[model samples]
Target: MSSGKYAFTKALKELRFHHCQTSPQSQAARSFLVRAYPTMKKHNPQTPILIREAQGIEPKVWARYGFGKERMESLAGLDEKAIESKVTEMATSEPQS
Candidate 1:
């Protein structure tokens, strides 16, 4: 924030919305984000997103599981290297539908 390295941190920062467990809006948002960038939900949200020149790291977003407060998958962090690796993994892991 101080560096102005990140803009729209409010919209894109570590959002603690339990996408899988509640309101349609959040669910839709999470769905859209996942489809656009499927690995956004894999890391701990409290994890610091630090980077040297990847512009800015992606914020960790998380969702809660069913019922009472269990965590679900995250889109993971957004560093270039981490994103690359995650993309590779997702590519390999996809069922090719």
Candidate 2:
């Protein structure tokens, strides 16, 4: 699926984000989601995008690919731009062996 600047690849099945809503470490992830969530959801309406929050957990992002394969990256201490770049890359690229 293609949206203005994002073209999600077919290999990507779902995206999951986990963060602590009240922790400073989650600040960037929250900010990135605020601005990017709408565009992502609009473009890939069928894909599951889940956001989970807790009280003191570390922030992270998960990308699930075909055949139940998955990859995860830490988001703790990352800035909004870095988080965006990581998510864009994960969302657009195919699973790597």
Candidate 3:
């Protein structure tokens, strides 16, 4: 599945997004979801994209890969574009395991 400059790789199993609904640190994550979620979901129907919201929690993006491997990235202090780039990198790259 392709979105913008990134394509979803087969190595990726799932994507988990963590953010606060109304916190400054989470703004970019929320923006990323708003702008990219639909396209990503439409293109990669088989992949699970989970969004978790909580109060005061740090914003983050997680990529789960095969063999129980996973990667996490902090989203704090980033802009929407940066968040998108980070997510794309995570989604397309192979897991270290």
Candidate 1's C-alpha runs over 4 A off are 1-76, 94-97
The global Cα lDDT (0 to 1) of model 2 is 0.89
lDDT of 2 by residue, 22-42 (tens): 888899999989889999988
Colliding residue pairs in candidate 3: none
* Model 1: lowest-lDDT 10 consecutive positions: 1-10
lDDT of 1 by residue, 1-97 (tens): 0212212122222224223334333344344444433233333244233211122233333422223332223343244444334333432231222
Q: For every model shown, what is its TM-score relative to the native structure?
A: 0.21, 0.93, 0.93
Per-residue error for 10 in candidate 3, Å, reads 0.5
**Sliding window of 10 residues with minimal summed lDDT for model 3:** 1-10
- Candidate 3 Cα lDDT to native: 0.88
**What are the RMSDs of all candidates, in order?**
16.7, 2.1, 1.8
lDDT on C-alpha atoms for all candidate structures: 0.32, 0.89, 0.88
Off by over 4 Å in 3: 1-6
